[model samples]
Target: MNKLIKKKIKMKKLFSLLWLLCVCLTMYAQATKLTVDCQNPGWLSNKITYGDQMTVKDLTVTGYINDTDIKFLCALIRDRALSGGRLNLENTHIVGSISILDDCMSNGWNCLNGDGHLASLYLPKSLKKISSAIGNISVDSLYFSPQKIHAVSSESFYGGDNKKYLKHLFLGENIDSIPKYSFIDCENLTSIHLGKKMHYIGEAAFYASTNLKHLNWNEFTSSLDYIGPKAFLNTQWKPDTILIGDKIENFDVSSFKYKDGCHVFLGKKVQQISNASQWWSSGIQNIFLHSKSIVPPHISIRYDELHYFTAYIPHGSLNAYKSDDHWGKMNLIEDITHVDSIRIFPTNIVLGHLGETASLSAKVYPEDASIKEVEWMSTKNDVCIITSKGTITATGYGECSVIAKSKDGGLQAICRVAVKESRPLTAITLDIHSLQLEKGEQRQLKAILTPENPDDSNVIWSRSNDNIEVSNTGIVKAKNEGKVWVYAKSTDGAIGDSCKVEVITHVKGLHIEPASLTFKKLGDSFKLRAVLDPANATDTTITWSCATTDVCNVLEDGTVTAVGEGLAVILAYSNDGHYPSTCIVKVDTSTDINIQTIDYPKETQIYNIEGKQLTKLQKGVNIVRIRKGQVRKVIIR
Candidate 1:
């Protein structure tokens, strides 16, 4: 009976060992990649299995996490600290009014154990009131989205020398102030974005963050009203600028005692400037005030240190700033009427070719005003990229704007940039090379761009002069009676064939000089001039002909030549008018009779070739008075 009992006890011990092995294997598998929901809360078992020694590779817990869960997450944080991973609480609701760090300590976990420093610990949106509860936890970078989180403890990000890992921190818009000693001794910290809604900074809030070079005091939305005493004391950070964008009412006497070399920019709502010293004991350089109100901010600049710095105010506010009660004690005050405006050149450009680049520049008004820096930005980064100095590089096919702004703030200009593919527009042709139209006529011109499938198929039509007007769709309208060249220009700025449009004005009427011309004899000639009714007529060509070929011959210049002595008529015809003007000619063989000395009787009558009675003798050939049924044709000189 004793031997049987000994065997049974040995079997029981074996079973216990095997079961222990299985549990450890399951725990390790869970550590690798575990998703713990409320339905399957196995992560609670993991907390018991490894406690402070647990190296949780990954743990995703959803629905909600409370103070007790924070205790268990401390063990999971151990693996993340070692592996350098982020604890993302995005979409995972976290219960409010609890110190996450204190919960870890209360549950037997020490943040100073080197397992507290994680890559990141993203707090949730549900976190309205927060506290660190005297715990030290650090990360490489952290982003806090301020939804309801308004309250923060002094120990929130303060690790008291245990945290040396934080580099960047972004606080959301709802955080109104930073607690005292919040970022003290963060050796490697470089940037901190205390969002736009912040109004105050507690005493020594950023003390001794030697490497912190960027503070978000320059944010435009800042309504920062006060700064606590020695807020930036004992810090190695020396900035070049401090731009407060909104209402910043006050600064404590020694708020920035250790800060140096910063050019301060107070926005339109600045209420005061402390003479107590933000910079010039460290030597202030420039102060720019943007208040348009006639009532100046109460400035406390000392009279003795007036010569140490220069202050700039709005154009008409210089007199206000010069008064002793305002910024009047300032040694130098520049009234800014000039630098208030800026313009960007070369807007709405197209980069059509391969690897195309364009340089942009901005000009601030009044050539002599100081502070002429420009910043550039690209609206579509995927389509194009712009440098801070305003150089553009086309990356993809799309259209976006390259904006250039004055570093002084509001004045900005935009250059619309269109980036096309490497497929270039080789050549372009118009459907018609020449066009003819009457006055006040219109015609549409079509342009075909080649390499048939070019990158930019858009064509622009323009007229060379005022003789014609062209529309966006290439419709040409004759504005005046003249010829004009219409061009089709491609988007690549390449030239194409121009359409020559000639506007014609038709002849209304034609008239020949000299109502009637009479030649005395054969081989006699007279030159005549033909004129159109409107002097600016288009077709001036006239045809000359004789009704009787044997009697007279007419030339193109309306010259009537007597070929044979006979009664004849010379006709001049206008081609466009489709009408003719006639001149009467009488080529008589009357050389024997001297018409210059010929005188008729009182009862006698002289007549022309048209049978019209003439009272006086004309210069050309004329028939003399007939007496007793006798006819006489005489030449008149």
Candidate 2:
């Protein structure tokens, strides 16, 4: 009986051990296949391991899901799981906040451990809103439909402790604004494609995102109105070009700050820069202005900012900007006017009768070009004469070609001019009523004839006095100091007009001011003014002569330019016989020293030649007042 009882006890112990082993195997299998399907009601409430800590290979919540299902899944992944291989919520009506960070923090999970083995996350297309703070999570990529999402709240992708694992972020269409600090410190985020409806970017939205490189600004919507201050501050991604959208209205200070050189192309309607100081601090080196953009007067930049910045304006707007109070202060404003082609209006024209005229006009390429000056020429002078002002006059019954050439670039447009017939000449009129010229001065005069006839409208020019001579083409030349009357008569001798011409004598004496000048460096120029004895003398022509061309050169207008460090004498002689004036120029060579390195004694005092105490060495010739009253000249290039 004792042996049988012992056998029963051994059997009972073995049965108990087998039962415990079966339970352990079942729990292990459950951990590996952690998945929840909310297709059926009360599916989450029916699960026994809903919020228990377990190692999960995959956690998927799919089919007919709601906010409660999403929150429960996030809680499971946040509190219960040791390692989540994947978390997918597909084809579910997920609405409301999905705060994974909050769930992890509330459950006392090791959020800083960065061991959440979540490699991928996919929110269902039915997700209508995401008003949660999903930051500091390690995920390789994130994709969600932004169709119903309005904005990315602050700290949405803030990588708090773990290094951001997000490589690409696809925010689908319909996202509007990105709140402040949304992606702050997301160091590993490389690329992001903004939604088509994204309009406003809040302050510091992308601050300290050092590794984020590329953002497709072209995908930005037309309704984008403002970019808040410091929106892109301290970003590592240096875009090559920043193209502002046409509908953008304002750019706040440091909105698109960058570290590398970039070119900014302003939109056509971007009329205001809220604070130009922000642009001054940005790394943009070139700016291309729109044709109609009006640079605001409130924009102010420092000298250092202008040193590396260049503004390119329309071809003809250079002078207009140069004359502006604010824009004129910019040193490197250039014209980018380029002509690709030209079109002449009225490709073919016909003048019905002699004395009948028609005006020709051309449309130049890049219509905003500043220089629209066209040179008009007639191919066949016997048929018609085209004035420089683009007026075609029928001379006789014939055909001719009129060409309009651009003065800026030599692009030409041609027009076929045909003279059908000629009418009787009634009156001849000169373009200029009267003319006054000094001796040796010459000018071309224009004449027009009226009252049509089939005859040549070319006029015959004559001068009444020998002092002034008129050419056959109506060019007047002043031969002597006297008054004369120049006449332009029609070929038929029916009617004519006269122009009074006056000539003045040459200057008798010339005096050059500042007889001597000194230059401290090469490439310096000084202007020499000539004073005539008679203040009203007409002949102010003077010749400039340099004693040594190797040392210095004098221009025709009496501008002495120093070529090297040497002494030179510049002579100014009056063309009308007067005592010549001399100017001695001495260019100092000591100022041309090239400084390789500087070594100064400790506590040495330095100053400039103007006796101002120097705290630091300046560019160019720096007169150093050294220790013990000893002076030295140092040139810093």
Candidate 3:
């Protein structure tokens, strides 16, 4: 019984050992799923293997990774180690050729064979070039953003047995050229996006891409310079619509071979067609040319190729095309025309007076139409006469119709012209009612007439005195110092208006009387006078102001009054802006001073500071003055 227990214990120890071994193996398998970061240069030489429970599941390459590292990765793919893996090299600066060998059997691994699963590549703008043999790898999807790639090499996508697996191709901007056989034999390529910067499509670039349904050649702008022969041969992309942009200037022969039943819109800048033997041959229906495009001399579509095709030319250029050497041979060329109409300008006209002339114009619809000239005639010549060139002249006082008829069709438009009689002279008035002038001064006056009339309302200007001379057009000249009356009278009737003019010599300087004055207390007033140098200066208007209004104040007529016990300056400025004068007024607060009544008459009235009449004067100050006369100051202490 003890021997039997020892056997059972040994068996239990064996079972525990096996359990620990299994757990270690599981941990080893889990740890073998590695991620090789190509950003670390150390990993570039590291051989990543698969199929022995050691798998490199993911590889990340940052922009710092160079082409050598990419080449190493491609070599690993060729050696069948990184098969069925994911390569994320987005925004990496990997450039140069990407070569993948077609002889997968040389690797001695089934993963590199025809049924081998290649790594999915995510490429972005940093990559510049893709090697021609990259298509040898059996990749299901290729995310390519070749914005920095200027040209794609020939046979760049020349996949051997794996050509049928490429599903999507994304071409980025800045790729201008696609060499011959770039995407040759990519039979399973279903979708492709071409960038706008592409200008040249080489021979057989997309040949035998059977699953591709449509190719948007319309994105090719004027930068599209050339298209090689058989560029799209045998492709399933028989697009129903093909729009060529305004920048494309040339198209080679057989460029769009096997493309049929499409409506092609040609751009304005397409000036040359090298050969048109096989373009739009099968089932083209319509071809619309830009309004400014001129067909080249070498471009000619055979009758059999375009039997049902119609060429739509510019509105006014159809005849030119039909008369040309090559374009004239096009049997279905037609002009784009619109419905015709007519319009007359200045819909309403008013003649100022009899015998006055005015001009009228007409515009025809479809400005470039064959018949753009119009015939102008007056409906009533007795009222107003109109020339054939649309010039109208008033004959008598009435209304008439100026009719414009299109020469091509019977469409006509009319403008109504009214000829009214001139208004009779009612009254005449000058722009200014009164005028004051200095010697050698001149002024231009305008005359306003009541019941304004453009004709028959002439005014005659005259002067009553010779001191100032009036011109025929109401210009007044001040010759000597005196007053005169300038009159503007209507010629028809003697009705008129006159302006009183005062002309005097110019003032050289200003003189202030009593240049200095003294005031004993507040409420003291003084009358100041400003005299022109010549004494007869017409500009006697003066403006007065006190330097300090808190101490003294002045009126518009040079009347100064002391308000407080302080000295102040009273200034007088002439209306002509020159010859300024000032008066110095001194005030004393030492004594109880009384206002002087000498400057005022006995009939002068007495009032408070607020200009209210008072039966008795206040104890401080009073304003005593006559109505419309000088003011007097008084202090009642």
Candidate 4:
């Protein structure tokens, strides 16, 4: 009997425990969800009252809880204000995690409660997520203590237009991953100070926010395993710097896509840059590679789809990026030979660089006998160090021509000399002055004659300080108040030719003008005018006259008039015995036809061949009318 009782007691205890568990589950299920219409004005006053603290009885959404509920919820939260009082949601329970779509952040739905609100909330530690589309809000700061949260999609706390009041951000310490497109276009995200506990960042996490300038991240989590496309598509990194964590291993092209040639810094261990050509040609105008090892000969560079391109070893990469032997080809002379008839001085022996030094004597004959003088000139005529007898000395290396004959006619030979040094300016002469120069104007100096052997002529040149610069062309610029000596000096220091510059300052006077003027087939008249010499002129009286008056007439004083169609010359003269001038005048004839008609009373009736009516008149002039064709108007006298 005692053993049976013990067995029954144990069974009873097990059933009791099961019954209690079932009761708790039933109560949880019975707690119904309560929601308040945030879009309706009465909901806030009736359902939510300031300081009316209450724990969530059941799963309660105090506002219009829908996919678009976050915006309204955010608005209601910010509307409650308390000075020196914090909005605390510590005891409140959010039954399920909130997940917001990405568009809410950018579509004005997220720009709710645009004023800084000091709010505190205690989410269920089991809460693993929150709406990523929590559009830009003006919350001063948030305190998130959820333990199970792992990811927050991009734009989670996006401060679209209300980003101004979102100066501070408090990321949940438990959160490790930030989804792509999170915080994108959040212009007011000035700084992102993350807790050291966070790890991964999804793609385009902070892509295109124009004003977000600061980001603080954990250094140990640099190796972000996965980043979605364009994670930071429209956002900027910390204006000052970006710190990467250790966990990052691979990044898609978009990771650095928006950056303008900014190289991703992969610490020291990376060797032999792979696929770096993209970094080179991808808008990177220049690059600095710091290395001490010589570039291997077989190393190849790749860009776009091509491979094996010689890296554009920059010009300044000598010591920075080392390379092996720079190869080059040997230089060789293309052509060499001696041209015939080179001039030389009788006492001079042209020593050529025959590999070594050797006297190579050359004999030349003037191809043209008309040459009065023959002399050898260096390749650079300046080294014309030829003796009076026509012998040349190679004081320098260069090619030269052996000139024969006089200025009238001459023959020549070209001899090329590989000159090493040059001699002084040799004999120079200016052609004797034959033309006159205007007063007050400077005369250009020209070197009329060059030294036959300029190499020997140590000619140093200069213009008489009075005024002149000896141009290389031997043309002199007059510097003196008046024309001065334009000259040339020889290498032996001798002046050869000279010229006189006449400065004419006088102006001559002459005058001419038309006495009559006429237009063809138009009115005829005379225009009296005169001409004066531009060289020398003064106020002088001029008289105009016509040769005859039959077709044109001229006044005794100076006017002329056209009498009929014809050409005439109007003569003009100065009161003194000054030069006389004449002008031609053309007169036009009337463009009218002449018609003759005679009428006999009984002979004919109508008009004449020219459509003019015939008329009879007495001996005394009688008034008669001539009709102008096609009109009633008639001409009569």
Each model's TM-score? 0.41, 0.44, 0.43, 0.28
For candidate 1, lDDT tens digit of each residue in 305-348?
54545566655556766774535655445555547788888978
The Cα error of candidate 1 at residue 387, in Å, is 46
The residue-by-residue lDDT of candidate 2 on 1-637, one tens digit each, is 9999999999999999999999888776666555566655335545536323366656666555433454455555566663445666544543323443212222222122223445666656554434332444566666666445577642333334443666667776767878877777777778777877887888778877778787887668465766777677777666667767777666543676654456666666666555433443654555443334644323444544544445666544577777765566665355556676788888999888888889888888777666767788899988889877778888888888999888878999999988885366778878888777877899999887676443567788998879987889989988897788999987666679988888886566777889898888788898999888777776677888997887889999999888887788999888766559888998876655444456667776667668787777777667776678887777665
Please report how far candidate 1 places residue 89 from its true position, in Å.
2.9
The clash count of every prediction, one per candidate, is 3, 8, 3, 93
Rank candidates by TM-score, best first.
2, 3, 1, 4
User: Could you list the CA RMSD of all candidates, in the order they appear?
Assistant: 25.5, 39.1, 18.3, 29.5
For 438-531, candidate 4 gives per-residue lDDT tens digits of 4345455555445354455443445555544565455544443345555555645554566554433332444555334665543455456565
| Cα lDDT of model 3 by residue, 214-304, tens digit | 5656665446766666677666776655566666666553566434345566666666655434543544454433334544334654544
Question: Each model's C-alpha lDDT?
Answer: 0.67, 0.68, 0.67, 0.44
Off by over 4 Å in 1: 1-60, 66-68, 79-83, 93-115, 157-167, 179-189, 251-261, 275-280, 283-296, 325-329, 339-637
Worst 10 residues of 3 by lDDT: 103-112
TM-score of 4: 0.28
Candidate 3 ranges with C-alpha deviation above 4 Å: 1-39, 44-60, 66-86, 94-120, 133-135, 157-165, 257-260, 271-297, 300-308, 316-637
